[model samples]
Target: MPMQQRMEMWFQAWNSLMQDMERQGARVWPLIIDPPALLDEIEAREKSLGISFPPTIRKILQEGSRQVQINWSLPSRALDPFSLSGDLGWSLDAFEWPYFGVDEECEDDKRYLSFHVGGNGDMLLIDLSTDAEDPPVYSWGHETGEFLLLGKSFTEFVERVTELGCIGAESWNYEALACEDGLDVEGQVAQEWKEWLQAFRTLTLDEAVQDFEKLVVFAKMHGAEDERIQAAFAQYDWEQVLHVWVKHIEQETTSSNLLPWCQLIVKTVGKKAESWVLSLWESEHCERLGSSLRAYVTAVCLPEEEGLQRVIAEMDEVVARKECLLGYAANSHLHHFRAREVILWMEPHVAYPIEGWDDLFAVSRPQWLDLIRWLDGNEAQRQIALSAWGKMLANGESPAGEADWQEIHRLLDVAYEKAILRKEKERVDRIRSALETTMY
Candidate 1:
């Protein structure tokens, strides 16, 4: 059948599918692809049909065959109805069953457990083992496909799984079986499990402290030589190396371990880390933590002239091209531009004049014109122009007189014809300079 016709058939089968789930005492997660909810459509279809499919029938239609969606609990989960409009007449049952499983640690004699379904209306079961720190052994069968292994019960299974650790094994552990051929199927199945085990088993608080101490010494003794290690030796909260560093620093020892760690904080994280720390600073509920963090940043990072100079140079570039830095214009990433962030950086140390109304006007006119052009459409454009013109005019340094208004309009028209919005600051600067000269 053509894809469009298959989609219609799926739509026609929607009522029967919902009834099937309800019959099995399972909640029906519909696969409707339309908005405004599929319940109303299902009701109308059911009323027209004068019958509903059994739970098995619904399971077959919904998941036993992947005609469309696997689950339809929300609008986001709904299959794209348009997708059904193509050649999509394949069935999920044709390839046996695909049961959706969740991560849970417990089940009776089961290390890993899941669900699947068969045509006989029976839900088959799947289970796996959890012997190694890495991915455990698991198994699956064709009968348990239609089940949705939910979270609450999964937690209960996890508790039981802890109890059953390594005592029982009746069948082949799917993960181990798959690994004998060197595939490490369970490892491939869920790599997060491997990472979690690695973190839990390999990285203890004490071990972390030892490594951190080593890192500190390595950074200070060979700051320039071991720049890579020094660079990598950051006490970043997310780093695997952080927990140890924090502990060692609190101990107040001054041996090689103590000196390097203290020095590492200054060398690696001190001044450079200050800006990053502020970026994450929050003033709401996290104000106390932010204050403490700021204190830490200040205490550890000694002011280095070289570091400060580099930071200042970066800030100056950002401030000079504020339009690009502020995302008011497309900027070449290689060439830095001026920004408010740079101004904030310099404000503490430098005696700088505050920008006035003229500066504001000079910065905004081009932005206003660009916005106007983008919004110049049908009703939407008309509404935006009417609503926004007053705000735009309010930002002008000197209000345009009759001749000035005529010139501004002409230039704007020229901008539209040119279809480019580059060098706007220069354009406005020239115009303002000419106006000043004419006045003098």
Candidate 2:
């Protein structure tokens, strides 16, 4: 027979065997397969991965390679049982190659006599309705012939697919289904919420926020709160307000997600927040938790005459304790780093003083000097130059020109010299001497 015909006959026979086991109510797969054909498939796959097959696996596959089985939500073909109880799913299993993108080329190849034993022992041929259309309903439901059952019995899998099918068949506009799915649901609901939120044909903003909040609570349980979720629900989507609020609370960052809390803090706090000296801090954007804290301070304690000062004081204290220093030599680069929370709070005037001296520690001096020239090498750079000269004078050194501060003149030279552990202290002293000379 041709390859195609042979594969079809194999599947037909495999499907028949599975149906027999289901009718018998044998929850455990007890079928077997012809060993040689299965071995051929395994050997071909082994050749593709260029690895030696374990002797034991070779023996098992050889002994019962021709078995066909139908068990509760597990598949068996000959001796090869793809189950948690089996060696295949274990960490040390020999069959765990091609994490993904393996069978793309040989999808049509009859690699094994796959089986579909549902959770409730509902066995049958492959779920054909799932593939009756061009793009399978379970788009990833079935691949080649490996039954993609997410550990669900037949009854449960069928119910899920049926519901998903109703949504899919209707372009996912199923409000009734969404509301039902939301009932008693727990955990990070991003995936489900994303699907259902879009699927709902009609839902008010208030309703959506409430649903989103539930989703947020679920995510909190799972530790899935991240920047992506915060940004997604940052906007005023009435359909997702509650979820956005949950994210805001979870994130605790004040300046980050400009959501209900962002506006809420500004609104509730009134002029206090409007005039409040904004404070800043950096924390992981776990759903804008920091932003929410900022809002809380502004909302709860603004316009109390000392409220703004108090808030700024508290913020500054937190930052200070964190050892954030506002040094001309070190902090000037903060301007270019957008995520440095402090930079968001600093007014433009705060940067004016050290704007010109940033080049001293720049990654590339050529670029810095080029920019300096573009800025007319004016009073700002002149001040930097004079400062460096003063530092050299203070250190009792002469201004030897740009080459004198060789570290800033060429990026690679300093990096190479700095990596030498023996020269570290000497390099540091030389740099200090150079700075003192330049300043004086």
Candidate 3:
């Protein structure tokens, strides 16, 4: 498939996730980008830097589309996969890469091409040596002052990194990377979407409710996961899907279909589904759970702030008893992430261990970090999370829990970089130096 199609599939996946996250009042992603630099512009950048870009990098720069860039909404996938977008193609020397290591023979300007970067300063780089067709990608670890192999070649990097983006897997998945197998992620995600598209294409409006679960099983066998439900819904007509989905849910509402169906209405159908969803919620069939109630959003549909306020109060009442983040709320918050009170509400709670903490720190840790990010947390907040996750990594089971630590490492890097931006340079230096000390 074309790269554009691959991206469209990715946009389909993320758009739904963005909506759900937005419903929680999170700031949408902050990484804005422009179109790829033109070939002449690429050469101009190379001329200014006094070195030739690696062959693969040059090809990408040349091949990349100069079309209008994707807006905040991801309105277009017209560009090439390798977005040298925005202030990209900037050198690593700016971030002090030379301070870590240097060649006696080579000048600082002729060193590396920074192709990809995390929000933190961690970058995936291409060594600009000999203008090879495909150079090995490397990351200069600020904590260790070492250059680590990220990928053996730019092609491999694209395959592996595209998979990471698709599955939201950890970067530098060592096990997969070790044998030089890149999980063929783009193909997998794209194929899964194709299967969903075909399944829905075959689907008839008069489809019997009894066969609904069978259809879901069929889709799963063809590579459907619950997380992709919204992406799947994005492909087909909502009213048509709703027509079939309601019939299926009418038969059995227990599984992933309920949330996806509810999401379809709240997201796509908006106000059209409002009175209907409300009536459905009150009926014996809808089961007035937190998930059911919090779907109201003023932006998409559900402008009835009075109704949403009622939902919030009920959610507060449940949490008042349990004290756990999930506590009695059980996957429901008042959907107040955007509300003015959320930061003040979330701040005091972060310091508390709460009434029912457990080994399943899974949900709480990320939740806390997200809240802190939105709260504009300081160095102290980053320190608390880093210190805690360090212990968690140490106590965690070997090999199996390794991915968790990798994720935490990535998140902490982001948190620390945020501090660096906040003029907590001293704090960030200490944090990196402390991590450096751990290497010894």
Which candidate number would show the highest lDDT if scored against the true structure? 3
Which residues of candidate 2, in runs, are more than 4 Å off?
A: 1-288, 291-316, 319-415, 421-440
Candidate 3 lDDT over residue span 1-440, tens digit each: 54455435544544454443334222345432235457777677667667666666565445542221111221121111121111122222222223334546435334776554444355656766645677876655544544666567765655554333322112332223233332343465444543443343244323422354544433322222333443544555556655654564466434443444444445434565555555544657345333543343322355555555555555566568865454223224433233434333434444333212112222233344342343245444444444433434455411121234355456656766665444344544454555565531
Error of 1 at 188 (Å): 8.2
Q: How displaced is residue 98 in candidate 3, in Å?
A: 6.7
| Runs in model 3 lying further than 4 Å from the true structure | 1-115, 127-133, 138-151, 155-190, 193-263, 267-440
> For this target, which candidate reaches the highest TM-score against the unseen true structure?
3
Tens digits of per-residue lDDT, candidate 1, 46-142, equal: 4554434333323334433333332311112111111111011112222222233444532442333223322233332322232322222233332
Residues 227-297 of candidate 2: C-alpha lDDT, one tens digit per residue? 44344345445334433433454555433233344443333223433333243333333223343355344
TM per model? 0.22, 0.26, 0.32
lDDT of candidates 1 onward, in order: 0.33, 0.34, 0.43
Model 3's number of clashes is 0
lDDT of 1: 0.33
TM-score for candidate 2? 0.26
Q: Which ten residues in a row have the lowest lDDT in candidate 2?
A: 81-90
Cα RMSD of all models vs. native, in order, equals 20.5, 18.9, 18.7
- Cα TM-score of candidate 1: 0.22
Taking all chains together, the TM-score of candidate 3 against the true structure is 0.32
